[model samples]
Target: MEVVSSVRTPLITGGKTVGDVTQDICVRVEAKPPKSWFLAMAISLTFLFVGLYAVFTTAWEGIGVWGLNKTVGWAWDITNFVWWVGIGHAGTLISAILLLFRQKWRMSINRAAEAMTIFAVICALFFPFIHMGRLWLGFYWVMPLPNTFGSLWVNFNSPLLWDVFAISTYFTVSLVFWYIGLIPDFATIRDRAKNKVSAVIYGALSFGWVGSAKDWSRYESVSLILAGLATPLVLSVHTIVSFDFATSIIPGWHTTIFPPYFVSGAVFSGFAMVLTLLLITRKVYKLEDYISVQHIEFMNIIIIVTGSIVGIAYLTELFIAWYSGVPAEQYAFLNRATGPYWWAYATMMTCNVVTPQLFWFKKIRTSLWATFFLSIIVNIGMWFERFVIIVTSLHRDFLPSSWAMFYPTFYDVGDYLFTFGIFFTFFFLFAKFFPVINMAEVKSIIKSTSTSDKALK
Candidate 1:
């Protein structure tokens, strides 16, 4: 009996050989980054600088530079923070949660998603740091040291402190998780590298991986443990983010439904961002053979399911607000639908609630252009969701006297633009430097395809 090597391509597939698929995927890395890449990089960098300038000018001036006032203390800055954090959640969900379920389709797109998570978290971190008004002493919030002159202690009970802890932990864990997965793939690149500079950099990052049996064994074990640890942390981080609102005494913010609602919304929005990136990347890298229509369809199912859950949460909040007869909560919900920001609220409902329902159609879900446009719509809706939640809830609190409308000033808009600038800048850089797809995981999938073919024969 001859033992089949899993690493080899199959002899036949629909009368076409497996070599064709491998050639389609592996050949593109040989080509230089297109002129379009430089164009995108230049554009993203310019936006990034403008964003930075906005942040710096605002920090030097004060929160007064923005449209935020006493009633709506947290406006665009907090909305942008929560939105970016929610966007970060999908990467860990794909890399860690799906891995535990043994979803092999994730292999092709997880790398890019994980990179997106890291960049999104970086964008999220910016708002909180600068929103402090006094950036130099912002570390005082979490330094864990007793204040000598002011007798101030970091409020352990405060949800804001909890957010600090939660966001930092999430960022660190995501970075580690992403880098560990990259090591072996980096080693593969190092082996294939022709230039001394490329070889040295990739070789250093690979941590001298030789692909020994023992090394693979340990690597697999560590990956499993990390995935297990990260799954709960991913769920918890967003829950805690919701707590930043729920734990507040504000009527709209103080709800028990927030944790699950936020998690679902996070996953929904995160998947949208993932779909947006993967759609472009698969085409740019000519990786459709690996990141197939099946993968896109599976992700669409997740988007629909999560989107429906989020829509239900929205309705449930309205029902609870009315049924409870809590005047403040009722007012909050009413104001969202019929208040100064009503247009934003309706936009949220239309984009997040109505648009994603179209994915129930197989034709819509599988069509790349349809999915791409829907992904953009989902992101827009998600942003509006955060805005509605933050602004609507806080803008008009219990006392009618304190009620006021909030709009983003130039500084506030700057904060948002910079956040996008940073996110796209990191993403563009990732595209140029790294293996946007995990070569090892893709190789394994290719090997599995070969085995499935042989078994069929």
Candidate 2:
């Protein structure tokens, strides 16, 4: 009888056993932070400080501290918000969608991906609060609670309100899903803890998780239900985000294709971010056995497919603009390509549309250095994609008299850097203190050897 394995190759390479998995993950957490970790943290701290300074200046002075005028109100901040939000989708996609499909390969990488999603959402949430200028009032006012200011309710008709609900829901579900998955791994760490302090910390985190048949049965059922719940968020969150633009009457912002286009672009950028982090993480933590080249190649293929879809969306936007014969819509696309911000549009095209095509070649997709470089490049393109959609559309409006160009102040650039600081700071800490790879799930697949592979034997 021929036995079939779901994955083409064994995910946990280097002949690792369950004990080996525990030791490998636990030691990293228990050990002191490495020099590389310190160096990365130092860089993140520097950026974080710069961002903090910018935020202080902005709050002190007002939104006027950055670049905002009548013509371009939603420039860098909203662009960064949407960009970060989109990059977050890959995490939920990997954990929820892949789980529902029973893709065994995801077991090795889902933990880190889900963590990334949570952090990315945290970063994304920062914008709406900060962009409100009056952070104190804006944050609270967005919530639909009865207040001293009677009848001052949130506009339910607004897509911005939709964004508020959608993002909060996405963040909550992703956090719950992530924490639930971490329980078993926390238990593993708890059992392996050598010190009293470490043991207590892990015990608290594990929530009394025991390696029992009953516990395992309950765990699996809850995970499935959560995955079922989170799967729609993988689509709905970005779709609502797209609604922020699609519902608007602004020529470039309003479009039927916005939902699917935004969704594809979100997933594309998200996979790139996952690749970016995993490649570095696998190397830094010596996790090559768990996060393999095959995994990298698989994600790169996703980038290729989604990048192509985004490229098509770009062309479709242009074609639709022309076909509609609406002067405002047509001018928006033409201006985006040929306007003063043409550099941005060109950069978006080259990075998002043209760059990922390289992955089509087997050599490039499999090459670690190439994949890492392209992943960063893909994110850069995706960021500029948002910038083009926001800044370019707003800079040149229907009225020539109101036309203006957006130039980012140091504060604008600094605010953007702040999100990076927060993202990496949280991620690096997660890597150092937790099992970056999912130990419980990977253990189950360690022996599901491919028919021709001798690694298991």
The candidate that wins on lDDT is 2
Q: After the best TM-score superposition of candidate 2, give how far the Cα of residue 223 lies from its true spot, in angstroms.
A: 0.8
Cα lDDT over the full model 1: 0.85
* Model 1, runs deviating above 4 Å: 1-31, 148-151, 450-457
The most accurate candidate by TM-score is 2
lDDT tens per residue, model 2, 17-108: 77788888878998997899999999999999999999888888888988889899999999999999998999999999999999887887
Q: In order, what is each prediction's RMSD in angstroms?
A: 3.5, 1.9
Put down candidate 1 lDDT per residue, 240-281, tens digits, no spaces.
999999988887888899999999999999999999988887
| Model 2 misplacement above 4 A | 1-7, 147-151, 450-457
